[model samples]
Target: MFLSKLALAVMVWTLAACSETSGWNNVIDSHEPKQGESTPSKDNSDTTLASEPVSVGGAFLVCAADDSFEMEAFGCRLEDVTGEKLNSTDIKDGDLVVSNGTQAYSAVAIEGSESFWHWYIAAPLADVSLYTVQYVGQIADILNVETEVQIQHPEKQVSEVTMESPYDDRHLMFVTSIAYQAGQVQNGFNSLASADALCNQHALANGLPTSFKVILSTSTVAAAERIRILYPVYNLEGNLISNPNQFWTNRHLAAVVADKMPSSSEEEEDVTLFEVWTGTSNSGLVKGTETCADWTDNTANEKGNFGMASDARKWVDDGGSRTCESRLRLYCLSQ
Candidate 1:
């Protein structure tokens, strides 16, 4: 399901036309001159390619580390003029290349057909940095492509910020715009599944994608494990809430943006201090079984972990618990 969703998300890439002349100050024309045309000359630092340039898209930061966190791979997707994805057989080894200002890395493995192509970097940047990806491979014939990508560490701080919308891609993490009324969280509707349903329902109603899952946990599952890949986590206002690394370490760049619920009456005004049900700790793990009996019990005797929706430092766990009957919101992230 994860891989399939990722493949589907590939369709959302901003067309390479977006790369035409935006922020790409250092231009390198890879297309060769025609028979009667003179070859265009460029600086010695320009990236070399196998043939003329073609269009490629779907560039974003990926948190692809192995168990030991020793391996890092940059990813991209190839698309034709019609916007159809290109298969792995279309490109050979050493065809696709990624270069930071200093070094270059080549494509190591291509996943499923029409899926993300992975380029392995021998020594990745110690910190998050922007990289220029240049591709020279064969489709119908020899072709080249180019785009920029950011490789982020799930536990490191981001030193650079891009002008693109943080929500440019499908990945996001935001608080619910509407808080549950105390009566709405009773027994049958208080489970993890129910919380996820509420999130998706609200997302769809707000015209947002319906791929959200609550950032919650039970005794057996950790909330941090819910999201497999960590793209930039953005809020509803199109701002980055935190870098992938800081999110796990409890170091956030800013408070998360909450979705705004439609106003039906003056009593529905936004609260200054919204509390979100988390049942998880700042570390992304369960908070000592403080999950209201795994989100089943809603009696006053059952206490569940909750976070301050406006506090970046205490967004996950506020070091306090609330009665299961209390009205609260949920933190949700794109699957």
Candidate 2:
């Protein structure tokens, strides 16, 4: 099903107004003037619901439920998982690395334990999940930030739905942001935490089993001046969902880019903030210091449903970022 760009924009804008706090770039490019959540940045409190989302048929959503993993299986972490609102990670170290087949594991467990639960391990493959990626310049992004780009990836395994945008004849997206600073790294940084929840919510809002994926940073006291990564093409998805076995801890087959960053002048646009696809949920920023990566991953498509008719190609041709959060469009698709 083809999505409506104008419609999507309107809906997103409306949702953002209600959220009162996220950076709705797909809809509204500016971050909230008030800082309602944690900062990696700053804030604004005056934004309100600009309008209401036009509901088709009726004003409510009737969703079809799925049989999936239950957090009770993971015990205390379950609540920690559910209660979380966002996932923000710091990329203390690298930029362009590819994923091996194995899950690109989080070295630091949330709340400080050794390893995450097996369920938590299901991140790259969980339903109703959140994932954020540090975005740089891949194809066409006018904004200027270094080392981090938060994102949302949604999927419905069995449902057929259509989202639309508002640009009448303009099928192309024009990303134009001022330059910013990404100070040369001294250590590694983790990816965004709240960015994870925002993405998962995107899928769920659309009535699909939710799963999230994004790129994050890990700091090493002496990792490198410029952080980079490469996940095996096979291990990586258009989103950052990578196969653990094939790409885990490995960098051979991964697709990557280096030295593709903002210069010191451009780095002045450096604002450690979020430019997101806003929705009707609470402000997109969950906790400044809290990240969802601490949650367990489930084996099943635990959030929504899906179908096979949607067009991802159009999403790109329509002006989506060349690499908003780590999608690789330059490589040849596996035949």
Candidate 3:
């Protein structure tokens, strides 16, 4: 059922461009001089692809250590595990990266055709251990690589405040902008099923070293970034800036802009740009979500939430989702 649901989500996403202009989205000019095209660049030579950068902090240990307390506190890791942990860290980019913790570590940051493996699990960043042995592999093939993000940072609208600390004294207000980037991990380019399966296989191969408890928590401070995004003009899913339990995804946020945003080229029009901030607490966990539609005409089961998921309810001033008003307060406009 979950696989079917994910498959449906992929289809819906494929159809997210279910509009007239969709045809014009990725038109390419074949005739245009390949500005930097090498005349014989297509030697079709057998060129060996370089391996990714993998960092192994320590040698393989039999135990896995998880900082469940911190993950729950950040609202990212819902499960908590307490144990004498053994995870690797102190590593550098790329390489068939394996983790040092009780469970194998997964740090994915790309998208394309994924197997069931890649879709169901996420890499927790809190105290992740780098493997001692090196890994060699290919990167996930994806689209929009970066620009496909639902919440984009401002193009060039940021402010500077050098005045004395507003909160350093007895009277102060905490402020920041809540932004999210759409993370797509594709298995083979345009291959969702493949990607999903690959991830599953990988996860199974790298089983969790141990079963530890996962904890959850909340804080008034966590709401800081979310508050800035909630504003008077913005209305997500017909709710005020404050809505909860409504599932929302990066794609949902993109839908909000797709429907509410002015034409991309509309002169002088204001559009909300976003950036994904994963595991904000320096935990290193990558934060993201996905969605799909059932498409059945039954009251018992709606076709889908119509892109209305709990995570979808952003523009919230609480610690739950992103908002704009908080941007005004922090005066740190994203770009």
**Which is the leading candidate under lDDT?**
1
Decreasing lDDT order of the candidates: 1, 3, 2
Which segments of model 3 are wrong by more than 4 Å? 1-254, 258-266, 270-335
Q: Whose TM-score is greatest here?
A: 1
Q: How high a TM-score does candidate 2 get?
A: 0.16
Indicate the residue-level lDDT of 119 in model 1.
42
How do the residues 141-163 of candidate 3 rate in per-residue lDDT, one tens digit apiece? 21111111111111110122222
Q: Quick one: RMSD of model 2?
A: 30.0
Candidate 1 lDDT tens digits, 88-185: 35455675566667776665655456343334444464422345556555443222235434333332222333323324543677787666632245
Candidate 3 TM-score, C-alpha based: 0.17
Ranking by TM-score: 1, 3, 2
Candidate 2 structure quality by residue, lDDT tens digits, 8-40: 888999987977655444356544434344323
As a whole number from 0 to 100, the lDDT of residue 256 in candidate 2 is: 24
lDDT of 2: 0.22
